[model samples]
Target: MISYLSASYIYPVTGPVLKNGVIGIDPDGLIRTVLSAEEAKNQNIELVTFYEGLLVPGFVNTHCHLELSHLKGKVEQHTGLTDFVQTVMKLRGADDSAIELAMLRADVEMLENGIVAVGDISNQAISSGIKRGSPIYYHTFLEVMGFNPATAKASINRALEFKQKFEGFPLSIVPHAPYSVSAELFEELRLVAEELPGPVSIHNQETPDENAFFERKEGGFLKLYEFLGLDIGFYEPSGKTSLQTVLPMMSDRQKTLLVHNTMSSNADVVFAKALHPLLYWCLCPNANLYIENKLPDVDMLRATGVKITLGTDSLASNTGLSIFAEMLCLQDNFDIPVEELIQWATANGAEFLGISDRYGSFETGKRPGINLLDFEEVNGRIVLGREMRRLY
Candidate 1:
């Protein structure tokens, strides 16, 4: 019932690396002790070893949308966020089976790619890995959007019903975005957050249009709201609130992760870091590029000291569900070190999701939910091995 991981490098967050490490795991999958190869030889266990591989904790993707897994390459760059949203709405209806299949498939992809857990945005009542086999922890953040004042309370009530239905799963209720959620609706959702759990997330500043619309009701989102048969003025929040508006509304337990913060003010990021020492700032780089063709200021986020986590958005907008690839993008464009980037996606992200006790590090008695980082062995580079289940 126990398993041992023989790794070249055991990167525990607390101390120096355990080189030529051997982690002895208990029958329940928690580690017993991380020791040297010599220590491992004296222990009684089943050993899993590779010639050249480093073992680290399973990666945690703080934000994603598994329901839109079917839309990976269907949308193009010229199509911004709103356009992608509309396209999914239209296409999701045309093929229900495909959407379900896509969701399950993406769940598997995440496991294969080494993602141990995710903070997913869920719509329609379908559960990712709920009915299927997925070895990943999911915190499904149910998305709520009701622009009509008449339906604000009713909308929240309905969401509460859904939360009850999925009470068996780890789930939560949250606003979709600043633009899409009305002030009254945000209040209702905030109330829900207070009663529910910690760590809520909302799409804060994904596009310039959303900013314009929130401030002046004067942008592409405003036009879309009108075209979609919704009124902008009816949901009037502060005419010009940004992070300033959301921070106060969010639970002081942790400012909800501000996603796609392409336009977060310096003051906002600073305030967030001050409010929560381990505040998570989630980045959906591909989603930003797919809709607006711009990325959030990565350098600014790194400088602000906000812990960063990666999300693949939906399969509809990305090439694959790979945090490794996401890290590659960060390094390609932002100059972040591989080790630090790995921590953001792995350790820090797990801390934000409130599952660090079970999944974040290669501690002596922790689950090292591992994913194959690289396929080939090469010199002057790290080589990760096959996907392995939690040792329990």
Candidate 2:
């Protein structure tokens, strides 16, 4: 049986908005076709489930840390990246039962928020069971971080072991962040990524200190290293931003997703675009404001013609895992068009994770779960309401 759903507006993500659009879906949730009300009327289609709001493809969260869900509200907000990292290190450990429960709740939350797919980061295999059983699609990133050059091989080996635990799931080995990975480890991970099947993700330029540390070896990261009791005697200043310093170590053959460009300049974006053929920039606006009390230069990034996606970092640094909320944040701050924001929240993320064929847009044969947004228009702008729900 085919179910027909119609709404005030339909955003397919890859195409123009359809007013009073009707979407035909198979019983298995695969999209069969999209047509206008006039087209449907011409075809003698009588039965339709009509909705009063906008309909869009379900959200794809490009970056998240499902393992850190237990840390929600435990850390203070607006503490800056260095202090935020220190706090997370101290409060991240908990009992197995507690961690599992938190992961389960976070998964449910994301689903209820109309998220159909996620690119989650995992340092351990603890969340494997939950992800395996989840209705929402998940691509786990086995995150490894080691600042000591001598332990580079050990770190990648450990990451590989964790990857084994997620055998049937879509996953890849990736670096945690620039501040926590050594040059040797970056090279080792690059080699692994070259052979890997998915895009690699890294936390990039989340703070000015990240650039300062690489350029002059002076910044809050210096204190971060001291707090971890790691010596960097052999490391030298690269005299460039962290993104510039690390982009060369990565493989241009493989796609790379750089998360949190809070301090990334226009030059950094240009350099990254020129050097890497396949590059994606992920924005976590709520988490950025929570940790650093700032947001990225959205105009600079957009102007550079870089592919941009959205993420809900983690419950540790955010109040909730809602892509709708992230979109509103960007809209409120940057006044980005709703159509463009929808692309970042849906198609762009699915493209980055290599799942565009199955998800992303509302194209025929794709099962990009349906989402309804009960929004209001004010002064020629979309004022998103809080009543977003999954309709599929």
Most accurate candidate by lDDT = 2
How much lDDT does each candidate structure score?
0.71, 0.92
What's the lDDT for residue 334 in model 1?
75
In model 2, where is the ten-residue run with the lowest total lDDT? 379-388
- lDDT, candidate 1, equals 0.71
**Residue 203: error of model 2 in Å?**
0.3
How would you encode candidate 2's per-residue C-alpha lDDT over 101-216 as one tens digit per residue?
99999999999999999999999999999999999999998999998999999999999888889999999999888878889999998788767858889999999899999999
* Model 1 spans with C-alpha error above 4 angstroms: 1-3, 26-29, 36-48, 128-132, 234-241, 274-278, 372-392
Instruction: Give the Cα-based TM-score of candidate 2 against the true structure.
Output: 0.98
Candidate with top TM-score is: 2
Task: Give the per-residue lDDT digits (tens) of candidate 1, residues 48-162.
Answer: 6553555667788888888777777877765777777777777765466777787888888887778888998876576644533567888888888877767789888878777
Model 2 score (lDDT):
0.92
Clashes per candidate, residues 3 or more apart or on different chains: 10, 0
State the TM-score for model 1.
0.87
